[model samples]
Target: MSKRVASSTDDVASSKKAKIQDDDDDDSAYLEEHKIVVEGGDARPIRDFGAFNEKARHQLEAAFAAPTPTQAISWALALRGSDVISIAKTGSGKTLGFLLPAFHKMEQKTVRGACSPQVLVLAPTRELATQIGVEAAKFAPAFAVRTATVFGGAPKWEQNHQLKILGGRGCVVGTPGRVNDFLDSNKIQFSLLETLVLDEADRMLDMGFEPQIRSIVAKISRPTQTLLYSATWDNKVQKVAATLLRNPVKFVLGDAGTKLVANKDIAQTVEVLDESKKTARAVEFVAAREAAKLIVFVATKRGCDALCRDLRRTTKCDALHGDKDQHERNRVIDKFRKSKKGVLVATDVAARGLDINDVTHVLCYDFPKGTHGVEDYIHRIGRTGRAGNKGRSHVFVTPQDSNLPALVRILQDADQPVPDDLKQLAFTRRSGGRGRGYSRGRGGSSSYGFRGRGSSSYYGSRPTGRFSSSSSSSSSGTKIRF
Candidate 1:
């Protein structure tokens, strides 16, 4: 909760500019082919390290058919005990990128004593912390690694018991506030800490957990191997990396610039419209895609609840936001993940680090606004198009949105077609002209329709035109509208 920056070592801060070494290794072809840019040190791209024991290797190979690009590069540097800064988009298997290395270190090292954790993973949100725990649990039994997760909203007594059972060895994944609290209360110790992983480092900083993170790191007595992973690389992340990591190797995918962009696998469609038509339009879109699992993102917690209520009338749906307790949020995510065609209406709280496969559609019922609006938009649409699977996102833009210029750039960068209406919205702001109202009405031409299979174009030509719609009907013989 402290807003102060992390204390930086003067010597390390002086040499914070990391060394660049992308194509100098024997596996340069592999790195180049995958478009992976490695910075900081001399570690090479490792195709398969054979570092994991037979049991652990088998489990990993079974769970993932092959190592993702993020996993391959991360394992190479991390296994060698080098401090690393890894930047990859969401759903890039970042959790295992650092986790497997932590487990590998545990295989060779021993813990200090009871209630002492060997590895600690810090996340910004409980959903992400719990998600990392889930990933750790998958390979824990195979590697004889015990894992515990702690975050706010969960019972302290329960987490304390979990830490006691974990004892000297194993990984503890938690949010900064909860982890810092545990450290202060003497419930957990870092005496045996061999590795520390900061998953989603940018989100943690954005959520203002820098002081707790620095406090937690300052408590460690030894030079633990540090690995920081994030979606985008910016000055803030770079500054934090310098203060925390010791001469870290920076591994990045895509443009390592500050401009945040969405994943290429997601086909994004943006529609500029009136605010009042959003609810009806969203309902129509969901009804049309009744067979696909969807995550509809809203701006406010209240909006999340209301949208979930509306969606439930057409199909099974759930809501997730900060207002809901941890238990209820977990239940909703669990239920949504299990269902084949369920809808999850949520706010920005569910935007980052929560991975769920089979989410085929994302609807921005409410567009992101304010300072972090662009990042929020990228993360919200990123909920789908995960694990190399193609997904789709539809964002409803209104005249009131001032972030249209940023939104247009994102769409253009992703190679998506920018609608004329969206360009006008952005142009209106730039040219100092009064807003020309967007169109609104009842039929296919009046609304931006959802395009089903065999449709020529998703957004059609303009905002007001004949957009494609699914002829598929529900079991009750009612025509699905979009």
Candidate 2:
């Protein structure tokens, strides 16, 4: 009789504990429903995420107290096998926009096995891939999720080990090439893949990862929610989106009718100067703020090396280009990041993956080539003024028959005042943009065209083809972030 009484007492205690736990869950759900709303802009802090569980909510709120433009919308709710295409400027907290949703969905489901990655994020460069991996690591612990990064420079075996052993059907952030290779090796399973994110989709296409990206996407048979993010859109970007997305919602951040354009926060200007005076102007610009971090962009490898050599004689600056191996590139970038008045002379290689903080100015020492349109120009200038910080972007265009009219048209389209010097170089407005104007609808098309290569000079006849009048210094462009 005494034993039976004790058993009944234990059963009653268990039932009471279960009831209390249910009450706590119900309370959490109620609070979450009211807490997810965020008012616009940087005016106020984000209320806690009602959708995230207690641990995830605490961790995310700790990492980021304020909601970015990307976070203003609930992207996590869109993870129901739907397609999402998000276009925002660089440093817009896009990484988290997709990551949080992906993490939430992964946490909801069970992995069949270790073969397939629950989430796959493709970035154009290793640095970007690693950056995303770092972000994943920050949240993985709170959610008890495993994350792995795969890229070319890193050890293949180590990545394999991480995914197969360390990662238990977790997330994989990697470059297209490396991930494609893994797909070939049968090392990763996509049988239960949940979400796929293509960050910087346009740059991946620009870097010629189209074949690899397409192949990987084709292999996934699982019903996966796709999220495509790009800074700019073109034929290639649209093509990828159409092929991958299924009736996705398109959002352009700004006034209702405004199309995507350069961030308005950047003060933009173009100087019409002779090549002989290029170095002197650069030196003067850097001297303006002896401690101002700057980035100077050049067009060629030789130009990158020559400019770095010249700048070092008077100012402390380093060269960055594709020629440098990953180690040296990391060293230079790291050193520059820590320097107060550091300057980096680089080619287009630095345009995409290099995201440093507090970049004050971006100087184009050399005019970009013809194939490089206003979109490329935007990316170069985008190096600075990131994350809503005020920045200055200046492009130097020499008076030549080939590029003068193009620059004139570009400046006018950007709603910037054309300098008297550039106005003198341009001919009477003729050709394409008479009635359509710069706002050519959604494509971000400029009526004033600047096809740098092989164009009939409407202006006074001047020598065409590519021409750069570099001074003895041979530097093209440089940028600094402090």
Candidate 3:
């Protein structure tokens, strides 16, 4: 699929007006294209908050003329002081969903006393926490609302200074460790917090921050609004919700809160190659396509470095992983976001919440590991194909990796096209395995049981690829078409 550039200025103006007018009758018309419908009950668009503090409403309107689906649901449910678990796709305005409620609660308290921040937001990465801080500022500017971000790799003294300035008067957004540190030191009082938000809860759990999360939550008083938001809600989230929330209102934004579906605007393709040859194939593919703004996801941090070195010898590329210093990682992300043609080789650390929306292509250098890994997969590919724009994702699969079948099944079930070669590879892996509970491919069967063979279920489907290499040169960089 060809990429769709934004229309001319006049065209954009006309469309915006049409959407605003449609807002009264049925805002769904403007959002229907992006809506993900589920069974059992139809999900309605989020309702407006009439009783909210005017300052909070103004901020929400400025950030988005109309609230996004996640934002709407969160505002309605969370502002009512309900515990919520929000499951939504990345870049679908999930941040604002929680932020709006936090802002309203803060504003309400401000009316009684000089705003003592009663909200705590925990994010998986410093970058994400910083992003949330920025959003929170935009959402509650009226209440002298300040957001103090606490993360590692920065000087502790500087963070302490920020906390001292906060003085229990503004929101505290930070990683679990730093937040816990502040709580232990009595620099921040968790008991005063009226809301606790666990952003990217699944990622935090995977990072072994569960102990810290529980510790921090234990510090906060009861009757606090607990909001958990993630791209996917697997067993871990359910377990946490059961323990933390009291009759929570669960909001699954897209496709019943399973693995985030591949963005419909993206055209995905898979290339089957030997494990040893995957890197070579990737370099060849990138060199052949002259892809601008590329991101490659590898499984390990060491793999990220090696791939960057290899790609850098032939083409300019940068590497990002957990190993890099936070400042350096932030610099690389900024540079990549601005560069016209550059590639960033990364691990899952860069996958969850780093928003580099201009990425033109996502190349999966390694297959993701499990269900949570699949959430990372969607986030990686979702770097491209944003805001109704078209993008491409190419997955490099090997015969030895038996997980390809389940991956293909997930994509197909999500309405994405699975290449013919991928289907052939799945059949080969299933039959070739030595009595490993593999079944013959059933023709025209939507539901095939391929469970426990790999990590996830093979949902409904059998699905139905070629390559060419060519190169062209442009001023920004060389162009390769494949």
Top-scoring candidate (TM-score): 1
What lDDT would candidate 1 get against the real structure?
0.78
Residue range 1-482, candidate 3, lDDT tens digits: 22343456667899899987676447455245545432222234565645466776666556445666777666767767778888777766677678766766776554322223477899988878876776676555665666777887777787777666654447878999988887787777755677889998988988899999999878766578888887777898789988998878786765736654666667777765434445556677667656578888887776677677767657888888888987898788878877888888888777765665567888987777665556566777887875345788887665445566677766786677665556765776666653223222455222222323232211101100011111111211112232
* Candidate 3 lDDT trough over 10 residues, lowest sum: 457-466
- Supply candidate 2's per-residue lDDT for 12: 100
Best by lDDT: 1
Model 2 clash number: 14
lDDT of candidate 1 over 290-394, digit per residue (tens): 788999888777666766776677777888999998889888888887788878888788888468868999988777878888888888888898776888998
Runs in model 3 lying further than 4 Å from the true structure: 1-65, 111-116, 137-143, 167-169, 258-260, 287-291, 338-341, 370-375, 386-389, 432-482
lDDT of 2 by residue, 1-482 (tens): 69999999999999999998896675445334423222221112123466667898887667566556555443533544447776667766678778887888877766567657888999998877866887788788766788998988766888898788635448999999999889999998788787899999988998899999999999999778888888766789989999997777554343211333565667777765544456566766666667778999987776677667766767888998878876787788778777777889888777776676578888887766566555567778878887557888888765432355666665565576676545644543333222222222356431333334543221112223322223333322222222
> What's the TM-score of every candidate structure?
0.85, 0.73, 0.74
Winner on TM-score (2 vs 3): 3
Candidates sorted by lDDT, descending order? 1, 2, 3
> Model 1, residue 118: displacement in angstroms?
0.6
Candidate closer to the true structure by lDDT (higher is better), 2 or 3? 2
Error of 1 at 471 (Å): 21
TM-score of 3: 0.74
